[model samples]
Target: MNRSARRDGTPDRGRGNPARSASDKRATDKRATDKRATGKKDAPGAGRSGGAPKKPHRGQANTAAVATNKRGKPKQAKPQRQQVEANPTISNAKPARHQYVQSAGPVKLAAGEGMRLQKVLAQAGVASRRAAEELIEQGRVEVDGHIVVEQGLRVDPENAVVRVDGVRVVVKKDLVHIALNKPRGWQSTMSDDLGRPCIGDIVSERVSAGQRLFHVGRLDADTEGLILLTNDGDLAHRLMHPSFEVPKTYLATVNGVVERGLGKTLKAGVELEDGPAKVDAFTLLDVNGKQSLVKVVLHEGRKHIVRRLLEAVGHPVKRLVRTDIGPVALGDGRPGTLRVIGPGEVGALYKAVGL
Candidate 1:
């Protein structure tokens, strides 16, 4: 209630507390010191006022220096590229080596040195040259224990071992030549698809093992008589070739009597569907009032040529029999029989065909 007391009856501390004022002054000073220290530590370039901008820290200084250098000076020239040589032999680079190398091409042989693979097979009596090629491609032929599929491979026949169908083949100096009197209802081929009779059934009994023989030409089922079977492929090929003009003789019995001058007419030529057919020679063997037997010799190997010729001339063939081919004859041998041809006969056939 004196000069220091207010109308609300509270005493004023501003005139009464010395210790409190001193405590406030110390706290204010400590706060000011802490603020100055924090400002000094946090502010950049605080200790280097009025001087050149302080250098950055070691890592930052290096980065700034690099950037300034890049902007201030021209870039140094890059190292010159080295020249590379293309040739491996001339350059230091080595050519790549291969573990395995392929052959450049097929092998070649000298003339008259080695025989062809097909020819060797034919000489061995395995088959004809064409059939031999097929056998080779079928992997049925081998030389010296290696399968041979490619044709034209020359081999030393005397030294190189050959096999067909797992059977060894020996080179034969004397080839086999056979003449078969193929009977009616017999097939000239070695096998028949219809299970009928085959010429192989008869010849297989006479030939040795691993020796295969084939007919030189085919005759129909109803046809009978001379059919040459041989292992001489060259001779057969030459005989069968139309260019050789090897003559074949046939005897035909016709249903009707052949008119006079029919022999001459056939020799001259006859019109056929395929082409003109002609006989090299013709002769009337026998004739009756109703039927006639005629002999025809032709060089062309046409299907049913003799019968077709007679049919065109108003005569249907009753029976047909091939009597001769080239110099080989059926002879008096009974039907369904075969005989080994003499060497002289084979030589004659070879000569006839210009082998």
Candidate 2:
């Protein structure tokens, strides 16, 4: 047995082999010294015990850096970025180029020329200013028969025939108009000195406090019908004036059957105590043995004008109910019912009065 052999009979290779040349040994030793100086890594599994893999050398260059090209695509010749110095006093700094951009809307009106449409609507109790603008934009508003679809349009409140959703809106804020079914017992007056039922009682119930309202025309205590009430003094005067000739309709239940010629006789003209009175139109609605129902239309606001005309024709009125005045109607309203006149009806009234 050789003394260099191990217990398994394998010879150790650490000592120089007798078959290797001295020059080869010297070359191998030079390689080991170069590896140590350059910090080169050993092959994997080299110098490892228990079949474990070898670890990377600590001083070796990073694998990624070694793989990367040393001279990458020559650095791009980039333009140097201009660095702007921020103004320390920002408030005093002016912008480079100032732009004055006007937002889109209706053209501005000259001062004192006219009022805004929405403002006029709000003042007239139609709707809020914002809501009125929405209405105008929706093409629901009109001025002088032209549908306006923009905001900030200036309009003459007195002259512009402005309508919202096809209903004319009177731009007068301080005015109000109402129609009431005047019951038979109620007098057509603001108040009764005798404490009898008068218009004030109905006004107090319907109108807000502090508003001064009066009937456009008078109705007798025994007469039941539609009566216009308003705070507009000029409108009331025109409505009651005989010049405008705003027609009024009345339903009269009279004594005795009315003959066919009664309407023609009333239309032709009837002699009255105050002078001659005539009906614009007339109709005999229903006739019974004891009572007759007649419909009469007249523009006269004289006291007992309908009664006088009917009596002159040999038919006395038993019950007189005025059904309409101008464009307004009683519309199945019970006695003592007060209704607020809508803008459309008010517009009709204005037309009837040359306003």
TM-score of every candidate relative to the true structure: 0.52, 0.60
Note the Cα lDDT for every prediction shown: 0.79, 0.81
- True-vs-predicted CA distance for residue 235, candidate 1, Å: 0.5
Root-mean-square deviation of every model: 23.4, 23.0
lDDT of 2 by residue, 192-291 (tens): 8999998879889545667778888889999998998898887888998998989999999999978888788888888888899899999888988889
Model 1 agreement with the true structure over 148-187: per-residue lDDT tens digits: 8888888877567676776566555546788889999888
Residue pairs in clash, model 1: none
lDDT of residue 275 for candidate 1: 95
TM-score of 2: 0.60
Local error of candidate 2 at residue 272 (angstroms): 1.7
